[model samples]
Target: MDFPQQDPAHRTLTVVGGGVIGLTCALAAADAGWRVRVLDAGAGERASWVAGGMLGSLGEGIPGEEASLALSVDSVRRWPALVTRLDDPGVVTATDSLFVAASATDIEYLRHLADFVWADQPGTGAALQPVTGRDIRTLEPSLSSRLVGGYRAVGEWSVDNRRLLEALRATATTAGVELVSARVASLAELDDLGPDAQILLAAGLGTAALWPGADLHPAKGEILRLRRTRWSVPPPGHVVRARLHGRAVYLVPRADGVVVGATHYEAEGVADRVPQAGGVADLLADAIEVLPGLRTYELTEAAAGLRPCTADGLPLVARVDARTVVATGHGRNGIVLAPGTAERVLSILEGVEE
Candidate 1:
């Protein structure tokens, strides 16, 4: 549906999608004293519900990704205050992140990345401490002996995305944002000429169906969750990652469980369903190599979701027209980028340049 222009007299905003982006937009808009409503087709098994919730913009950034890096940095900076305002305890964890390289070339690549990041801010690269195998094991006792060297990036943190989603849902409800559970038939359904009424399309992969030729597609990611007690070994103190041949694998530990994931499949026309057995086995094998003890962990669940991806691997947060704003194409960084993205959307609605 087309959203009307922002009118000082209008109060209602109909937000499409109840995923991380949509919920965050609703909460932010409500905080700004606007009546908000959220709509979603899938209440369960959404990408936001299944994400590992790592907030590491440094680790996720690729070379020449200045825009994404800027957005991620901004979002990370806003996380502390945003979580405090939400007042949701256990939503954020301040554990540092470890990026390990199994080979000499990978270590050099990491060093180059560190150098580039440091070049942006003098003396900041000193924060990433170089580590030996001994240090790696000492830092995270669960890691295997196969790793050569790694670097610890302090201040890189993670959040429990499911819990964050729950908190946002609660806050939206408290703020009186209406929740609608149904598939949106079309964007035209949200069209309105009123200045204050806005239609925000924040659904992830679902946005593709609403806006044809948006040049968005899905990148499937499969994750496996394991029970912590099945292994006799201690858990890693921080998140563990391995720069593998083609893709990277991450081990995210939580109080309730440990998440081992994920594979980024760039195939088209794939269905959004539960993770396949082969994919789960592949992820487990990768995790087991990083932490051999994970082989003994009891498998709890396997899930897969389509991360909304764009051609340039960046997010699209702009006004498609007068009544509609597109905010999808977050890919795997939806949880990490929610706050900053919402702020930008609010600014756009208020006619402020980002």
Candidate 2:
């Protein structure tokens, strides 16, 4: 994949999809002096719009997802660099994340996770501390009394995805990447842009519609945004992912509100677009069961978004051809992986192994 350098003023890169990944890629390509334009479907709803913005790779990992976990760990490392490059200090939260276990089964499951990560990843194991139920209560008094033990991935951070989108929009505009609204039903139709246009198909789930064999599907997840009174005891100061009765739920706190999510519903045979009542109900129940104070929080918003995923959860960031590249299937880690995905696309453009 050795792509020769083309003069920025002469080469055009049209990215299909205005989500986090597409916008980030536009910014990076603009920085490299390539003429860039982003085409979005103009639909307001998208996976990036509703992501919980958790940067907790250590907490999200499971046994068979080790390969994707490794990719995530690498992406997490690139967050600070992106923040610096974007020169937006307020985009990401400084608060760390906590993996909490609210019952005996949770404790055992978390213990297994701890053992796996500690043995599987020697580099970052020492910093991941095993926490007792008392330690958890001590750190966040709002936690339920029935909690068992969990572990803490110290220094892991979450982003305000809404703010990150704004920041990226501002940065991309400032970098001179043209933002346009266009629904690309056909990849070949984009050739109207120019003869040398490099079409980057970074269109989340929309990629599947453009190609019959595209290895991508949508996973619908429902999340609730709860608001607290300024005077109320604040929710957990950090991200808390709990495994209660074999179900996993996470509560991500932000200045605007606490993000309680998420219930995953896999679309079996066809695309399921709408939010399910059962999914929302389960997330709310699980979230409240772990932290009692959330019961009093105002239910500000309930929304569902579809995450583009591959069967194995690995992102597709390979060259479709010399002039086309596909980047999607990031699943739940799209926010955390956007910077690294941008890096990967740039590498492909430069004809390097991504």
Candidate lDDT values, in order: 0.79, 0.82
Which segments of candidate 1 are over 4 A away from where they belong? 1-9, 117-126, 191-195, 244-247, 270-274
lDDT of 1 by residue, 1-354 (tens): 343445565767788899999999999999987888898887563789888889877778678786787678778878887788789868865468898877788778777877776336433465578788789988887787878887887767888777888899888899889888888888766655355567788878878789885678778888888776744575576877777553578988776657777888874564666677888878888888888887677788898878888998889998877657789899889888999999999877766743
TM-scores of the candidates are 0.91, 0.94
Runs with alpha carbons beyond 4 Å of true place in candidate 2: 1-5, 268-271
Candidate 1 accuracy as TM-score: 0.91
Weakest 10 consecutive residues, lDDT, candidate 2?
Answer: 266-275
